[model samples]
Target: MKILGKITILLCGSLLLFFTSDFPDFGDANSPASLHLSPYFIEHTLEDTAVPNVVTSVLADYRGYDTMFETTVILTAGLACFLLLRIPKRAVKNRYYLHEPTGVTLRFEGDKYPQESDVFKRIDSSWVPYDIIINFTCRLLIHFIQIFALYVVAHGHHSPGGGFQGGVVLGASVILFAISGNLRAAIKRFGEKTAALFSATGVFIYAGTAALCMVLGENFIDYAALAPILGSDRIMARSHGIFIVEIGVAVAVMAVMIWIYYNLSSAGKQDEGL
Candidate 1:
């Protein structure tokens, strides 16, 4: 029965592949995607939305619904990690004994030290001390990185960036914080509670802005209605709305990435034996 199931699954997959072989080739100018939606979006989006980047327009306005789903995916991932890898209030540590191929052994007690062996000592102790100057430079670069991430989010309308790219950059800045200092320090700066709250707040900001549009008697994402408050024309209102959502995405992504790093680094510590 198992063999039959495997064979059936393989046959079905092959049939699907066979059918897909006739689909339009990627990046072909004559393909339906290139000729139809792409051209229309390219020619009209700039005039209608006042954004120079076609991809940004597609993501933020032309297909804003899809962007909403993408944001939801981030939220779902954060929730799953929170549920699966949550650290318990009380956890124990395990002791490990290190043994070398050569017959040397070292035992660690109560998470105090790593198992030590002669071979391990050579490898671990051989690490040259990092230079203070280099560490200082890296610490300084983190500030610049955060500033650049904000620029990316803010300037997304006129260029090839948006919430997703900007969010990744912001998330990477926190990873630098983790690498430069200890994980505990990174968490202290951006704790699990703060990360979770930021993520929720980001989504709320996006949704609430759209809701406000609805209350003003426009469609859920009709940025034209927001033009009065934003102090801009309809097209500029769209640009402003996209910028706001991009900020939300950056916040959520940065928080989630930090949260994931924290959980993964602390996983072994969570399962220690008493």
Candidate 2:
């Protein structure tokens, strides 16, 4: 039975690889991908959507339903991390060395000490307070990162950036803050409760704006109905709507990333533990 199972798995894998050979080559100028749908997006997206970045237009407008699901995937990952690793209210025993000798000449009952160096001295617990430095730096970086993330989200329509790229960057900054500072500090900046709220809020913003078009007797995401409120012509409304949704995506992604990192690193410690 085992032999038969292994053979079946190998055959299936080989068939998958064989079929994949028919897929488009990466970055081939003459490939069907480059010549067909992509060409239309590249040459005409700016004229149609009034967005200079064709990729952004494709993601936010032409193929926005896919983008919505991608954002949901991020949200799912964050929730999974939170559920699997959230800190329990009760405290658990922490297993870390309080004090141990460092030198070349120490071995007793299958224990060994590495050779001492000046570098080790600097990093020694007696000399440095890891918590304090990490907390301070993390606090400072969060503000700067938030501003930069907003800029990336806003400028996406005019340039090579967009919601997904900017959202990931924003998410990473929060993750960095979590790693450098600690779970508690990171949560203080944006708690899991707040993160969940913002995630829903982001989706609402995107869907609500699109729904506005439906209410105005147009297609779901037809931005032409927003021309009056957005202070632009029909063409420009699409760009404006895309920008709004990008902001929503940025908020959702940043919150979810921080939430995930906190749950992972802390390892379910209600109080600080290593």
Candidate 3:
């Protein structure tokens, strides 16, 4: 089966590469893609959407339904992993601790005693000696990573990045925490319930925004109709609406990535994980 899968992938990639030979040269002005809609999108994006970033305007406004469905696919994958693998009940055996003073390890049966003093630090079942460099460096970098991710999302209208890209970066920061520190710390910071809620809320914000336009007497996902609510002109309303939906996409994608990571890493046991 694995060999067959590899052959299939190779065949598909070969076919795609062969087809690419017939495609127009890069930046060819006479190409069909360049002639048909690309020109119009490039010329009118600023006027129509009031967003300088043509890619963002197209993805968040013109092609929003597709992006929504893509986000749904991500959410679905997370849910499927959770449903299939999440273990509600599991027996934990050994509890590991690190003795700070003597640099020795201690293991206790079942759970650790409640009255255990601060001499020992309770560690994950798979815990290693605390690496001062990795832990401290991650602590220092996590904040900057999150802030940069937010910047990418918010400034995508004028820049190259967008919600999907920004969300992936944000998710990577959390995953970095899991890698540099411990999965237990990551789970404690962003629990399963919170991640699920974030994923749902993001999709809701996007779908609800589209529905709102319908309620305002326009077609579904039409941002122009949001003018009244936003106290802006039709073009500006569309711009703001795009930003709003982009935010939703970012939130959903971020949560789904984290959720999938947690499930796959722990095999859904929700205990110590990579």
User: Top model by TM-score, which number?
Assistant: 3
Error of 3 at 1 (Å): 11
Question: Which TM-score value belongs to model 3?
Answer: 0.84
Candidate 3 lDDT tens digits, 137-227? 9989999999999999999999988788889889999999998877878998999999999999889989999999999999888999999
> What lDDT score is found at residue 137 in candidate 2?
78
Given candidate 2, what's the lDDT at residue 221? 78
Error of 3 at 150 (Å): 1.0
Evaluate all candidate structures by whole-model CA lDDT and list the values in order. 0.73, 0.71, 0.88
lDDT for 251 (candidate 3): 94
Error at 144, model 1, angstroms: 1.0
Give the alpha carbon lDDT tens digit for every residue of 82-140 in model 2.
77877663444322232234432222222333333442221221222467777787778
Each candidate structure's count of clashing pairs: 0, 0, 0
TM values, all candidates? 0.77, 0.75, 0.84
Best model per lDDT:
3
